[model samples]
Structures are given as structure tokens and as C-alpha cells.
Target: MKDHPLEQVRGNPSRPLQTIRQLAIDPEMCMYALTMSTAESKNIKEAMADSAWIEAMQEELHQFDRLQ
Candidate 1:
């Protein structure tokens, strides 16, 4: 699997919940993003409307899609 960009913010205290939110909010997107299972995508987008990393997050997704 490809490394997740979220790893940049991983050490942050919110990493755990952020991970949960990502998987919970968008399982399919998460699967595609991290090249990982929905159970573990290292994290993806959230249900909320305002994510500062949303853009970077989307870019991280499918980046390896065609390659894979």
C-alpha cells in the first residue's frame, strides 16, 4: 500500500479519531486512498463540510489508483 499523506499529521493527538472519522465517513474513498482496507486506510475524509486538508486529501486519494 502507498504511504498516507495523513502520516504528516499522524503524531498529532487527533490522529486516532481522525482515522476513525475517515474510515467511518468514507470507507470506499479510504480504501482507494490508502490502498488499504476500509477497516484501515490510515484515514480518509470526514462527514463534516470544513476540512482544511480536504484538497490535499483528495489528491492523496486515487494517486496510485491507475498505477495499481
Candidate 2:
């Protein structure tokens, strides 16, 4: 997996967390629930660390292609 362009080169761990917070504000993207599952879980941080962001972006791009 790779890192999403928006997630690329996150200066620090907080960066992704911030982005996640911001995205959550978008009503359209609200369905893409990204939050801590466990009591001490940190899904945003894990997303940044695991490079799931990139994979998600890639998936989104494919979805766009299919529509065309």
C-alpha cells in the first residue's frame, strides 16, 4: 500500500489526525466513518502509519474511472 497524496509526507502524527477531524466535518464523507474503535484506539494515527490513506485514494480513483 502507499500513502494518499494528501497524506504524503505528514510532518508529524498530528497532521493526519487533523485531516481526519476536518474530513469528518464533511457531510458527504460522513459515511466513511473513521474513528477509534477501541477505548484507546487511534484509527487516524493508524491510517497515517499504515499508509491506508494512499490505498483509499487509489480506490476512490478507480471508482471515478468506473463512472466514466
Candidate 3:
């Protein structure tokens, strides 16, 4: 019979939950979706001062360049 994939890695069912949790949170295999903030900046100065907003802007510009 063919062995289950998880069983092949873990060898036993003693810590299935832990194994699953480790796989779910593994950095090398997992990438989180980028999230945008709902908060609005009053002006350019305010938006530019916030690092998160700056990063979001850079990512948007990168997408434009990548598609073109």
C-alpha cells in the first residue's frame, strides 16, 4: 500500500497537530498576502511620512513596471 504523505514525513500520528501547525507557519513555504490599510492620509506629506504607505506605493509602481 502507498503511505500517506504526512505519515512519510512524520513516521507516526503522535503529533499530527504540531506537524500541521509547523507546515502552516513554515516561512520558506508560506507567503502572506499583502494587505492595504483603510486609513486615509490627509495630504502627500502625511502619506509620504508613513512607511507602510510608502511601501504600498512602491509595490504599486513595481506592478506597473512589471506588467509593461
RMSD (Å) per prediction:
12.5, 13.6, 15.2
Q: Which residue pairs collide, candidate 2?
A: 4-54
TM-score of predicted model 2? 0.30
Residue 27 C-alpha lDDT in model 1: 75
Ranked by TM-score, the better of candidates 2 and 3 is 3
Candidate 1 local accuracy as lDDT?
A: 0.49
> 1-68, model 2: which lDDT tens digit per residue?
13445444333444344455676788544444332322232567666565456577789999999999
Q: Which prediction has more favorable TM-score, 1 or 2?
A: 2
The candidates, ranked best first by lDDT, are 3, 2, 1
Once model 2 is optimally superposed onto the true structure by TM-score, how far is the C-alpha of residue 68 displaced, in angstroms?
0.2
Instruction: Score candidate 1 by TM-score against the native.
Output: 0.23
Global lDDT of each model? 0.49, 0.53, 0.57
lDDT of 3 by residue, 1-64 (tens): 1354542232334544433356557654323211122456789998887767799999999999
For model 2, state the Cα shift of residue 53 in Å: 0.7
TM-score of each model, in listed order:
0.23, 0.30, 0.45
Best by TM-score: 3
Error of 2 at 33 (Å): 12
